[model samples]
Target: MKLLMMAACAGLTLNTAAAQEMSYGHAEYLNSCAVCHGVDGTGDGPLRDLLIRRPADLTQLSERNGGTFPYSRVFATIDGRYAVPSHGNREMPVWGRLFLEDDAKNYGPSGGEVVTTERIHNLAGYIETLQH
Candidate 1:
């Protein structure tokens, strides 16, 4: 029936959107966070032994935060707007600014902020999906 076909199409569209969104975040993570957090978000990255402080296991974030995903907190951390001691005296690059820089380079500066926000949110959403 038309109704069944419509529902199936809608589901496919949603799934495709979700897959694209997650793919963006996953790619960003691999490029940036995975060096310290590991590709699996296990805090056992190859560079872990070189860092002064151990990276937190991203998979345990929900467990540490009382069973709810700390969406805002993760966003802030990735955005690097506020100082976080855990990020080590701000030595690490702020991912938000980095994304903005890329956007500005590719699309000019008109809507860099929007792209930056999307990048951070997508990354945070992907991290949320990684929660155990």
Candidate 2:
């Protein structure tokens, strides 16, 4: 029936959209955060031993913050608006300007800041899923 076909098509559309969103976040995580945060979002990245201090176990963020994910803090930290002490000088890079430059290259300067915001927001949303 048309109704059944429509429902199935709608479900596929939603699923495809979800898959794309998850792909963006997962790709971003693997590209940027995994170098320091590890593939599983723990603090056990390959470069962990090279740093001055061990990175925070990302899975514990919600537990440490009393069972709620610190979404804003995570966003700010990703975008360089907030400082996380454990990141240290050698461990963390200020991604805001770098992300802006990236956006400027891809979409021009007019929307660089907005693009950076979206990237950071997506990255934060991805991190939230890592909660224990």
Local lDDT at 21 for model 1:
67
- Candidate 2 lDDT over 13-88, as tens digits, reads 9998887867667778888888878998998888888888887788999999999999988887778855656775
25-98, model 1: which lDDT tens digit per residue? 89888888999899999999899898888888999899999999999989998998666576568545688778
Give the TM-score (vs. native) of candidate 1: 0.75
Full-model lDDT for every candidate: 0.86, 0.83
Candidate 2 Cα deviation (angstroms), residue 4: 38
List candidate 1 segments past 4 Å from native.
Answer: 1-22, 84-88
Q: Distance from true position, residue 23, model 2, in Å? A: 2.7
Pairs with steric clashes in candidate 2: none
